[model samples]
Target: MGKKLWYHSSCLLLFCILCTNSFAQVKPADFKYVDHILGYWRMPTKHSTFTELWVKKDDHTWEGKTHRITGRDSVEMDNMQLVRSGNELVFTIAAVADPKSGKPVPFKVTVLQSNGFVAENPACDYPQKIVYKWKKEDELDVHFKGVKEKTFSEIILEYKRK
Candidate 1:
């Protein structure tokens, strides 16, 4: 009985720490200036490259396009929308692989950072989490990871401003 109680107590403590440190909500002042995410970013690998374009549409809306580049051609791989509603940021993505992308799914931002944010769809089939990290003014790192096929995996992409 003592061993089980200890284990449960430890798990609860860890959960509290993770919840406090990993998630953030945008305040009015912070969401007021998300234009930093607007622009172009490219990630190049030996085999292929990924590119993203973010455009500000207004005070509360943005559009993003992601492409896969090999050789010289760029193929659109994902279309996304970033919207700020009140104090929350919403992400809607249309991925080429999702047949139901005709009606995109909305993922709300759960972790808001100084320069980037993470949005998630816990109901998704594969990559349920998406994270964008700004390493520098000209560098962005993106992570796509979650439980897929009952296995946890992550894909990291490093991007530089173009």
Candidate 2:
């Protein structure tokens, strides 16, 4: 009787684990909407040119990096990832010199559309909200908003496909 009980408990545990893992995995169809963002995007400023390169790592994950180029020097500013976590998509960013030991900060994607999406992380110190909009086939607009110096601030970046 004890042996049977132990076996049932083990089986239940295994079933629970399997269910959790299955639910956590992202489906490939859910990731297809973000496919259009894969490519090289460039935004030139007066002092430097900012570039973002995005590539798909797998059906469930996309990786990206931002770089600032001034003269002959190119410096990586941040690393980004778009991944499916369960039924939802998460956008993560890790600055090269982040104050929190460069840990990746996660922003939950709240709005997803054919042309763009919005991700928000209210707990983040800066850029609590991130917005991406496609202006045209070759143009993209990105906006970051948060509080800085005790005042609300927002920065907009316009990029062209390169």
Candidate 3:
């Protein structure tokens, strides 16, 4: 009788632990702050302009496209998607010039806030982290950071709402 009671207690404890872990997993509604990034943004250089347009696809997904324009020529740089997967918010990218035969890369979002989010993919060669922050209502700042040539390096791109 003692062993049976102990076994039942242990089973109940394990069930509670599993329930708590499942409840702790991330969900689509938790990323509602991501809606702030929807719209068009542009960064202009002396010779070219880089633009990103984000659109909400559904309650759990957002799609973004990036393009570079110089003179009368426009070229797509990449396609990006922010999606709520089973237990994570993933940032997936497929770049036109990707060296890995254009295979899409997936980065799991680690931080989420009202103004920004950080996504990381440690397996990527160059940029292992991508951070997006809103500086103001009209300004957006994006940082790409990783190890390059055995040294830590970062690239920042500032965009204005267009």
Candidate 4:
């Protein structure tokens, strides 16, 4: 009787442990993935350098600043916004701000996020696309399509943790 009771107690303890281990824990929405993308990313190619500022806003929206820097010339800004649509991520550029004018002009572009981060530019007659690939080392690989071959350089844009 003593041996049977001990065995029954061990089985009960094992059952409890198995049940706890099988239960899946829920992850919070504002977790690691979203946090990683929220910062300044510097993209450097053989030809030029560019920096993008990703600012998180209310309602899962992001304000972005795309700036191109060349030689001694000042930064040229492209103002844009990003919002998640369904399972895909969507980006809309409000305008391409000219340094000379210092004004925001009408401009728009949309990109569908794929397995890798892809931007689809369908507004123009020719389709322009941008793909952002992540490396194992935590660097972002950027590729531009429908543009000049040599002109489109490979850049590793890395995010700085805040």
**TM values, all candidates:** 0.77, 0.76, 0.77, 0.47
Full ranking by TM-score? 1, 3, 2, 4
lDDT of each: 0.82, 0.84, 0.86, 0.53
Candidate 4, 1-162: lDDT as tens digits: 999999999999999988764432212332224434556777666777777777888555677787887887747577666565444345555453345665433222232222134556534222255555555334555554554443543333553222
Candidate 3, which segments miss by more than 4 Å at Cα? 1-29, 96-102
User: Cα lDDT of model 3 overall?
Assistant: 0.86
Weakest lDDT window of 10 consecutive positions for candidate 2:
21-30
* Ten contiguous residues with the weakest lDDT in model 3: 95-104
Tens-digit lDDT track for model 3 on 23-131? Answer: 5455556587799999999999999999999999997799999999999999999899998867589887775125756667788887777788888888888789999
Clash count list over all predictions = 0, 0, 0, 0
Please give the range of 10 consecutive residues that has the lowest summed lDDT in model 4. Answer: 106-115
Model 1, position 3, has a per-residue lDDT of 100
The model with the greater lDDT, 3 or 4, is 3
Alpha carbon lDDT at 121, candidate 1: 79
